[model samples]
Target: MPVPGGSGREFNYPDVGAGRDDVSPAGYRSLEMVRELGTGDQIFDAASRRLFGWQMHRAAGIRLARSTPPPAPGVDVRLEWGVGPIRASAWCRVVDVVDEPDRRGFAYGTLAGHPESGEETFLVERDTDARVTARITAFSRPARWYTRLAGPLGRLVQRRITQRYLDGIADDQW
Candidate 1:
């Protein structure tokens, strides 16, 4: 669980950069993308199953040091990204879940000593028309100064990763 004011071993709930703050330019930024994938409940179910099974992380090439599938709120997870010379790691905890009639998914945020600051939510939904869509929404800012300096380049990388996430959940069969 996150601690107030973001103290030691504690992350921020709703995540520090997750659009709750609006006063600062460097405060937060949000991105949302929705892609059509299959149809009906099965589509949502497939994406939900993939999400909980840690397949999305696999698709993103992220390695879970302590693998815990089927994320539920409050589960802590350690993640490693990149390979060989370039590597980054972080400890995060799942903060929210969406299990409503229209949507299903969850969100996780970084812990106290993470390299980046933010929260991201993944959702799979079946609309009234029976069209299923997978959507990702992220609000983030760099915790490290170097990452903050990267700016536009960082955004480009994020964009690619977001697309990859969309691709990861695009299923032909429900």
Candidate 2:
């Protein structure tokens, strides 16, 4: 797909978010790239001890630490694509933890995980507000020239898979 303004850069700052002219522009791109390749919205309720977001693409069931509060290390995560035996491993952390900006109802955490593919993250922006939306934009590059031919095909598959997964994640769930 062509980027707006004909930049042709797959990573669109505003489109995927994480692009901040104010701070960490490069870092934001890197983080956004990770999210682009996997799940980008996550929620972990320490009290509940359940890691949600696995039902969607790049989502995984992880075991969290009760003593360390929510989003602690050693949280096992499994992310996958295409129904194969292919999977990746990683963990989540509340990198930019903060309270609800609008002061509504819920708190949120941006959990980052890697399924061994490279790196991935789930970006759940709002918890206090019921209006929320999430999408998985996992990315990959085929090996060898012949394999490159399948890039378009791969993107098609990814889009279809992500859309279906998004159907399960509701506005409030994000």
Candidate 3:
């Protein structure tokens, strides 16, 4: 079966790929995070590789239940968190991929089963100074009752995970 609320199909939320734009859609929470990973082409390349390969999610303690390698547009990915029976799963589809001379990353939109309805973009950029920076942008709103109940806690968790994504690139242990 096809993923519900997916790209070319349907998204759980409207304004698909809004995360990449400067304006956040109305009635949704917006997030933008930037962190300097390091300097040089080597670090930029490594960070890009990790982000595309899903290593950032792994490093952030999220289980990559399934994903299409290299994260191309239309690719589906299932991510899980928590443990055992308590595990929560989020399904999404890659809506767009950034492959520019100075930037590399992709954006995925929430599917039907996702707790939140929206899109998130991850980009690794290298400036003229060769300083590598990681940027994560997202716009979302709770889709499930539990997430809605989470209220402020949900935002906190999202921020924490976003930080871990940057830390994953900065640390580069893997």
lDDT of 1: 0.72
RMSD of each: 4.0, 12.3, 2.7
lDDT values for all models: 0.72, 0.30, 0.86
* Per-residue C-alpha lDDT of model 3 across residues 1-174, encoded as one tens digit per residue: 255443344568878777777577999999999998878989999999899889899889888855356798778787888977798777888889999989999998888868999988999999999999999999999999999999999999999999999888777742
Task: Please give the lDDT score at residue 135 for candidate 3.
Answer: 94
Query: In model 1, what lDDT does residue 127 have?
Result: 86
Worst 10 residues of 1 by lDDT: 16-25
- Considering lDDT, where higher is better, how would the candidates rank from best to worst? 3, 1, 2
Please give, for residues 1-174, the per-residue lDDT of candidate 2 as tens digits: 332332132221222322112123232222221111222224323111121423333232222233334332223322233335653332322222223332111111122322112123333333334333342333233323543566566556445544544443332242
Question: What TM-score fits each model?
Answer: 0.82, 0.36, 0.91
Q: Rank the candidates by TM-score, best first.
A: 3, 1, 2
Off by over 4 Å in 1: 1-8, 12-26, 171-174
